[model samples]
Structures are given as C-alpha cells and as structure tokens.
Target: MATQTLHRGRLIDHLQLVVNDLESSRRFYAAVFDVLGVPIGGSGEDYFWADELFVSSAASRAAQGALTGRHHLAFQARDRAMVDAFHRAALAHGGRDNGAPGERAYHPGYYAAFVLDPDGNNIEAVHHGDADRSAASVEISF
Candidate 1:
C-alpha cells in the first residue's frame, strides 16, 4: 500500500453548542475530551471550550436565547484503544451509549464509538487504522 500523506487542521473555525444546562454539558464534554487527550482550550462565565468546539449555556449572548438543535460531531482518535476510552468516559459523565466501539463499514479499518452528549447530540470518536500524516497538526499564525 502506498503511504498517503495528509494534512488535518483548520477546516472549521469553530462550533458552538448551546445547552439548557451548561454545567452538565461541561462535565460531559470535559470527560470526553480528556480521554481523547484534547485539553480544555479555555472557558468563560457561561462556557468552556476545547480545540474547535465550544459548549455554552442558552443564556449566553452567543447562544441568542435558543438551545442548539441536536448536532453530531465526530472527533479524531489516535487509535482503537482511545476510541474505547472515549466511550467509557462519556458514559461515566452524563452521556448515553449510542454505539459501542467497533470497526464500521464506513470504510476499511474505520473503528469508532458513539455517545449521546448531555444535549442529545451524537458524538463520535473514530480511528482510521494505521496511516501516515504529513503533520500531527497544523498551525495557522495570525
């Protein structure tokens, strides 16, 4: 098989999830990201954020007084084991099991797990078996 080099980064500027209960959503996402090894980027009075996703309360100005409808966000995982850990952490912290970790027919070696976050959003962690990347991540300087 030919080694394919890919660059993964900066597709979406950001994603915001406005929830009815901010703290519950916070705990749920915090646990989920921790297992995936993405740290909380920062937080404010009504929200907390990771790399590209922001979880906030409906009361926050950015929420515009409405809760976001259900959204599905798939995160990248380093390996199959990380996908398993994400499912467990999500379930332990206010998430419901949507699907267990396993290889999916989405494509060869597409192993993943799904969980419903506090706002009923379908969250997924997927690991596309062994592959090569041009960079672990990319940085765009302002």
Candidate 2:
C-alpha cells in the first residue's frame, strides 16, 4: 500500500463507542490501529479517537447516554497480512476472537478478520483485494 493511500471507510461520518472501561478500549484500539498504520488522532480522559472512529467512556461529554449495544465496525486494510496482524493485536490487547483471519464469501477477494472489542462490539479489519482509489482521504483543516 502506498503511504498516501486512504483507507476509505463506509458511510458513517463518525462513530462513538461508549465502553465500560475506557483504558482497556484505548489500549485495544491503539494496538489495532498501530498495526494497520493508523494513529490514535487524540485522546481525553474519557476517550480516544482515530480517523472516523471514537471510543469513549460513559462519562464523557460527547458520550451522551448509557453504554451502547454491540456495533459492527469494519475498517479497511491494505492486504491480508494487515488483517491478520489486526486480529493478533486486538487479541493481545484485550479483544476476543470473533472470527479468524481468512477470505469471506461476501464478495470476490474479500479477506477479513473479526474480533470482539473490550465492549463486545464486532470489530473487523478487511482487505477488499487489490483496487485503486482516486484520493487518499478527505482532509480537513481548522
């Protein structure tokens, strides 16, 4: 994958996961993203974020309600190796194996792995085989 490639995410603008334990969630995400070559954009006492996903404690101001139910979040991976690494990192950092890394019948060349995050959300890292993109990602400036 090119260093400039953007892992195009799905339709959601931003998704917040209110977890029971913020630290565990943070560690879990940190590791997973690290292997996928994404960084934790920023963090607060009750939350940590990356690109379009945010994980927060129930007490955070942005985390307006009780803990959320299980959500299926699929992140784009550059290849099958990255998806495998994602599973290993998640499991090593407090996640549970939901599904092993392998090809799926969802479509041709769809390789993915699934893990249950600290909060039991179904998190996935997938590589939709080789493809091309027009731009890396959408950039915003303040």
Q: Residues 55-142, candidate 1, lDDT per residue (tens digit)? A: 8898888998898899988999999999999999999999999999999999999999999988899999999999998777776433
Candidate 1 local accuracy as lDDT? 0.88
Q: Whole-model Cα lDDT per candidate?
A: 0.88, 0.88
List pairs with backbone clashes in candidate 2.
Answer: none
- For residues 1-142, write the lDDT of model 2, one tens digit per residue: 4233233444667788999988888889989999999888888888888988988888888878588878999998999999999999999999999999999999999999999998899999999999998766765443
C-alpha positional error of residue 68 in candidate 1 after TM-score superposition, expressed in Å: 1.2
Give the TM-score comparing model 2 with the true structure, all chains together: 0.90
Q: Lowest-lDDT window of 10 residues in candidate 1?
A: 2-11
* Model 2, position 126: C-alpha lDDT score: 95
